[model samples]
Target: MDVPIKATPKQFYDVFCNKTHYVSNVCPDKVKSVVLQEGNWGTEGSIISWTYAF
Candidate 1:
């Protein structure tokens, strides 16, 4: 899913790629946790895991 936002690419990366900024700040009730499984955040081929409730 592609989302168009008001923020620039850097700003988008800075927020969404900062691990739990989206989950913690935006929708904490829906997401439990986010784990960087294999690679680094904001990097290509990075593996991310999400734990959500409801």
Candidate 2:
């Protein structure tokens, strides 16, 4: 995939680490689906996992 050259790659590269409040609840305090976890900053030997069930 080709990313837009003028896009905010630096900020967009983040996994919502800077802003967490904007994230909504998964199940209103019960069951949840999406998850966000923090690891190391930047893309140096770091990995992010995303999963969903259908």
Candidate 3:
């Protein structure tokens, strides 16, 4: 699926890299929630858990 957005490539990358926890808010229908399971967000070796709405 190719969904176009107004954001620049760097800005879009920042969302996934720096603000992963807020991704669920971007696509609430597809992503139910995002949790930091281990370590810290944006850190190397960190683990995250995602719950999908589907």
Give the CA lDDT, 0 to 100, for residue 22 in model 3: 85
- The top-ranked prediction according to lDDT is 3
* lDDT tens readout by residue for model 2, 1-54: 563543376654442454322223332343223334545434344454444343
Tell how far residue 31 is off in model 2, in angstroms. Answer: 16
Clashes of 3: 0
Location of the lowest summed lDDT over 10 successive residues in candidate 3: 11-20
Score residue 54 of candidate 3 by CA lDDT. 60
**lDDT string, candidate 1, 1-54, tens digits:** 675677778876677766542655566787777878887776888888888888
Reference-based lDDT, each prediction: 0.71, 0.40, 0.89
Clashes of 2: 0
Candidate 3 lDDT over 18-40, as tens digits, reads: 78998898889999999999998
lDDT of 3 at 49: 92
Regions of model 1 farther than 4 Å from truth: 1-14, 17-22
What is the Å distance of residue 45 in model 3 from its true position?
A: 0.8
Order the candidate numbers by lDDT, best to worst: 3, 1, 2
Model 3 segments more than 4 A misplaced: none
Give stretches of model 2 more than 4 Å off: 1-39, 52-54
Candidate 1 shows a clash count of: 0
User: How does model 2 fare in lDDT?
Assistant: 0.40
What does the lDDT come to for candidate 1? 0.71
